[model samples]
Target: MRGIQLQLSQTQKVRLQKALEQLESLSSKVNSDASVTIADSIPVNHEDGVLKGHGTTDLNGEVVATLCGVVERVNKLVYVRSLRSRYKPEVGDIVIGRVVEVAQKRWRLDINYSQNAYLMLSAMNMPDGVQRRRTALDELNMRCIFEEMDVICAEVRGFQHDGLHLQARSQKYGKLSTGQLLTVPPYLVKRQKQHFHHLEQYGIDLIIGCNGFIWVGEHVEARDDMVEDQVNQTDPQVLIPNKDSVSFEEQEKNYTALETRKYICRAANAVRVLSSLGFIITLEIIKGVFELSLSSNLDIHDMLGSEFCVLVAEKEAERRSSNKKKR
Candidate 1:
């Protein structure tokens, strides 16, 4: 939706309108009563000792919603889960952020939270994967590891006295490259066990950040480079040179394939359409849209057209209706 601006014909507009109506109808049947807006009163029995949670306030004697969201009840506790709001971080959640500042012993990242998250140098593993004390040399070379405006992926390490702390002890967590980052509403992305996806067919990696940042990039196998270095050092006969010494032109030869780049654009467009339609974002659904576009023989750029948007709405409506019937 951020980059898509379509000019639709009259017929396209009518079809899109009808499809959206059907989608709204299907959604209403599932959660019509559960959804609430700001200042809406929540029904609760006072005799049971109700506890008000986030997004709810006591208005005289009634429990009124302080924000527009869905009312959630957990035993005696009640709260409103906001449908659209800034990201609220929790411990152990994976997030993608951009480096905003490089301070002493740490780098501050903009993680789409109330404040920028902090990534302490000591918390992350060194490039050599050797667990040693962070010396003064390490502090001086901090910019070499991460400079300003570099996009990185890390895990939330809980709040400290200064602010939110992050860690990147694993090989999977580090600076991301050769990728396009898309931002959506945090609520659209639901937390799951696996957020990192490697679509083998498309030859790309997808990272659905819990903080509403989605990254589509070329896949790099997760391996410890230090292991390879250790092997080189142990074997005197091995003539393999250091990867860091590779010439820039040699690295350029490994650029992403043209077909893979097309697939990336298609995958990115699928996410854009789904987010614009207010549908829940998931790995399976994204792949579905992508495959549908391919099956229809639509060009990568045409996926952003009004007709495709209507088709996606209709497909989602049918899917939801069938799922409801199955239940």
Candidate 2:
């Protein structure tokens, strides 16, 4: 209950416990009532307990229901209907992930499920805006876009025909180049609906997965004035402004955006990596991973390696492909 957010209050917990105890105490007396037959076995009708149901057994040797009032007949099925949650990944779902390994032309991601998900090089879009099939030149470094601890977001691309392939693709789907990653419980991740949808508010690129993996990184906000500052395509916005002359409002907004972006980015990356390790990716885990001298060691530049993380992710994808066949 401590781990679950939807836990009952202390008063409710005590009341529920008392109610269960009362039920247990009254159970025997109710069964022995005269109106009840107390048959060698509960009747089939009562067993299901559906119709003033009594605990009864059927030919299949299963209890269908638990009857409370009278044991009218024997040799009947009675039991409470059991239920279970049976959900699987879906397309278009935004997922937070870490590149666990890279092999060949793919990246493997731990999407907080039983199996690590895959992202293929062919699914990658080139920076030059050229739409060509991924080539040998696209050989993954396994650490470029998705490092061992990088967090990323992408759309669910549907599984392969073999039922083993888990893919995520789309331009909207890409690596979080800056931010923190945090890992909450899998249950919390499942209940979250707006995963990665509100990053613009905080200026962080956030990705989350049902498996409790999350990635956070910094993203520079689009600047209206900077739009006209694009002097060259290769090296846009060359004019440097004096740091002291910047207005308080602009500076405040930029600083706030930068700080929020870094905070979320780090949280997201830490969450994804933590999810992959099957542990709660806390600030402690992050410090340990980077071997930081101090908390301040948690800088974006140290952890956000775009190319390296990507290659690591690709390797993970290759590993997932291999495991799927064995399954």
Candidate 3:
């Protein structure tokens, strides 16, 4: 209901309701009473003292929710995980953010948090992937590494004197070129051990950034920009006509392969549809949706059609039911 704005026929509405009901039924088995709305009192009457946590408040000796989300009880601790909110970064969380500003010693990134995240030049690995100290020249040429508006992937490196800090200490965490950045409610993406996926069959890399910024693009090996001391990088074969480079025609020519691009579009559309339905996004589930599209022979553009939406909902209902039975 967060972003759903569909006008369905009576029949479609009934079917959707049935599917959603089935999903609710499956979810109800797991402490169904845990769902709460704002100001709702959580049903916890334990003798022991319960520590109030985020999204919770003490109201007249009762624990009440400050957000509309499901209540979770971890041992003696009780808290509500808000279904709608910006990303809450934890240490080691892999995130995708856009460079918003090049500050004196850091790059401010808009990573869907309440405040901008900082990526200090000193925290990042050197351009050559060497363990060298950051130099003043590096600070001067900060834009060269990450200009404003560039999509970057990094890890949360704990808070600092400057605030929420991010680090790109590995080859995998740096500038993200030639990709589609998809935003969804951060809760939809479950924290997993691995977020980066290389779909070899499609020749695309799927980076499920924990901050809800998903990236889909042509697959490329991670290599340091400084490591490329190749002759071509040092000198151009042809003379440039003007200071303005990367002409429109040349840029198009450098685009991902035709088939790979098609796959990227299809994957991105599949993700869009899933996010619209408020589905829990995981690598396996996303791949299942892609296979569903292929099996139904739905065109890339038709994945968003009303019929497809209904089908996806029904399919999800079935999948959840099957999982419940397995459990």
Candidate number with greatest TM-score: 1
What TM-score fits each model? 0.88, 0.44, 0.87
The candidate that achieves the highest lDDT relative to the unseen native structure: 1
Compared with the true structure, what per-residue lDDT tens digits does model 3 show for residues 1-327? 446677788999889889888887788777568778899998776687778888999889888899988898898889998777777899999999999999998999999889999998888876766587666555655666777899999999999776899998888888887779999889888789999999999999999988999999989888766222221232334332332365888678658888998899899988998899888889888888898999998899988877778888899999888887797
Model 1 vs. true fold: TM: 0.88
By lDDT: ranked, best first: 1, 3, 2
Score each candidate by Cα lDDT: 0.86, 0.47, 0.83
CA displacement after TM-score superposition, residue 254 of candidate 3 (Å):
4.0
Model 2 weakest 10-residue run by lDDT = 223-232
- What lDDT, from 0 to 1, does candidate 1 have? 0.86
| lDDT of model 2, residue 201 | 46
TM-score of 3: 0.87
Q: Is candidate 1 or candidate 3 better by lDDT?
A: 1
Enumerate clash totals for all models, in the order shown.
0, 81, 0
Q: Supply candidate 1's per-residue lDDT for 211.
A: 97
For 1-327, candidate 2 gives per-residue lDDT tens digits of: 122222345755565445434434444544554233223343343334533232443535433333333434333422322111223577766667777877667778777667777777676554444566654434532243344655556656778853333443345556664455555666444534555444444455445555555555565542212211221233323433443476878656655454675556455554444343233333334434333212436455534333223322333334345555586
Those runs of model 2 whose alpha carbons end farther than 4 Å from true positions after fitting are 3-87, 140-147, 161-168, 190-194, 199-202, 219-258, 261-327
